[model samples]
Target chain A: MKLTRRKRNMALITMTPLVDVMMILLVFFMVTSTYLDLDMMPMVQSESEGVAAPADPAPTLLIRITASGEARLRGQPLTAQSLASALASQPRARVLILPSGGANVQALVSAIETATKAGAENLRVVRLEAAE
Target chain B: MKLKRRTQPPPQETIVSLIDVIFFLLVFFMLVGRMDATAPFEVSPPVSAAGESLPKGGTTIAVAENGALALDGEAIERPALLAHIADLLSKKPGLFVRINAHGEARLTNLLPLVTALERAGVGDVVLVITPNPA
Candidate 1:
């Protein structure tokens, strides 16, 4: 006499737990993420392609930013039109932005914006070191 | 004659489509979002028109309006922060350092910190700025 054994059915895998985990992660990322449009300005670049010097000593234009965030050119307040016209006359002039230590970052950025808009190609921010 | 009423079986609700949708959403959030450690204090970066696009991967140092300092979302003192940065620089000489300073922060607080970082042998340093101010 020959004896035959019965086959056992396989267990079913549930996908509910996986779906729950994915949903949790989605919500967590959505809540914690901030959508800010950010940009960068290089503070220190080791390998700078130094700009070549002009044939003659380049004339420099000094723009002073006061503690109140006012930008002055030649002791006059900065105006976009006046600055553009002045730059148009001497296009090769290097612009030096001398900001007071008390001034905010916005003030420095605003002054740089004005200078760039006025077609100043060679621009530099002059940092002040406190005398010890 | 008596007519018997016949009932049809209910349609099956397939969860495959639900899983597919959730998977896509999960991948979307993971790919698009930058998982950066936020600063403990509020920092509104200065607005700039000429700033270039920032690349991923770096250590972030936050500067508050009152000259407070934070590194990677934890508030830290200047000396400790510099010492920590020095240690990182020794391990990885080319570590990119990002300074996320508040818009109203004085340059006195910002410039000196940058000078110290440079003195600590930081090869590349970038300032974080916002293209659009809200």
Candidate 2:
């Protein structure tokens, strides 16, 4: 008896399921993810990353943030113009921000922003610790 | 008279292009959108034009306006949070931490946390902010 071999047909793979899965994932990301334009201020940095302190200490300018969210420098309301004028005389002056515990985060950020706009190179935030 | 009938071949609907478009869209979303877990409570970061662009890959701690805290999207107490972070720091000494605190959060809530984080051996810590107030 002679056996006959049957020819095989090429199989077609469907892509509908793949497209469906991808579309679902795309929608999920679009719906659940937030697109915030975030920025960051360094609160702590490694010692190696920090700039070396000057051999001779620069003059320090203290800016205080009041409880009412007002920034004061030398008994005057702190403004960009005032800060710039103050930094003009001493460009390398160390600008220290001492924020009141009652002050909100916005006040601190605003003070930092003002100082940065006024060309402050040596900036530091002084934290007040309770005495034991 | 008898008329001859002609049958035209049906048009083929190609699905390969559709698959390509969907795959591209999937890849775009995956690349552009961050998968960070958001905090349960509302946290509006302080606005600051002086801030630098935030680098990615850090443990995020969210502080709400009422001084509530959440670490990596899980609501946690201060001591517990600090303990957890200390453990993480023990494993990875170079752990980076990002604080996403609300603008209305008092300095009492923020400053102390920062000091504590520093004490916990976190060398790199950043405060998250937004350049756009809106």
Candidate 3:
């Protein structure tokens, strides 16, 4: 009499470890990541399109922002409407926003918003460097 | 003779579907979330409506509300930060720098650093702003 051998079943790989690893990674990213809606304002420009203030120069409008977030143009507090009307008169004027160093970032941003709404095509933020 | 009863196989819950979901979620976060190094301190960027869409892939310098500085997540003194930036510029002249200044941070803290960066030979620099005010 010949003895018959039983068939062996192949081992199945377990997915429990894979699932655990993935769950851990997902939580790590979700907890560590910050989702902030961000925008940019150019500070140091490399482009050559903006020529240096011409010798003759176009009409220039100086808007100064103080520490209290007040935008003063020619000693008057500037509103968007006022700035727009002023810009309308001199469409080609160069608008310069000079912000005091003591002012907060919000003050500078608000001043910039007013200038853009006023339709000033050539806007620049002038920074004064301290003497070494 | 006794009749034999057939044993029904217990239904197996498919883990493949769960894996597929987890895979997609991981990809979703990896794509949408920015991997910029956060500053040691809290830094909330200023809000602006006229800001342009920010481009990615640049060194981020975070400025906290009290003027604390962090370059690519490492808190550093101003001189050291500028020196490192200057070294980077010497290697790559057209390096782009992004200044993530806190909304409440004074211009004094932000502007001087920017000026130093410019003089350090960095050609392009930008200030980070939030479209939606926090």
User: DockQ, in order, for the candidates?
Assistant: 0.72, 0.77, 0.72
Candidate 3 chain A, poorest ten consecutive residues by summed lDDT: A48-57
Which candidate comes out best when scored by DockQ?
2
Candidate 3 collision pairs: none
Expressed as tens digits, the lDDT of each residue in A16-122 for candidate 2 is 88888888988898888788889999998877345777799899999999999899999999998898899998877889999999999999999999998888888
RMSD (Cα, Å) of candidate 2?
Answer: 2.6
Which whole-number lDDT from 0 to 100 does residue A37 have in model 2? 86
Tens digits of lDDT, candidate 1, A21-62: 989998998898888789988877766435577689778889
Interface RMSD of 1: 1.5
Q: Specify the highest-lDDT model's number.
A: 2
lDDT for B84 in candidate 1 is: 97
The TM-score leader among the candidates is 2
Candidate 1, which segments miss by more than 4 Å at Cα? Answer: A1-5, A49-55, A130-132, B1-5
- lDDT tens digits by residue: candidate 3, A1-132: 999898889899999999999999999999999788889988888783356768878898899988787899989998888888888888778888999988999899878877887777788888868545
How would the candidate models be sorted by lDDT, starting from the highest? 2, 3, 1
Clashing pairs in 2: none
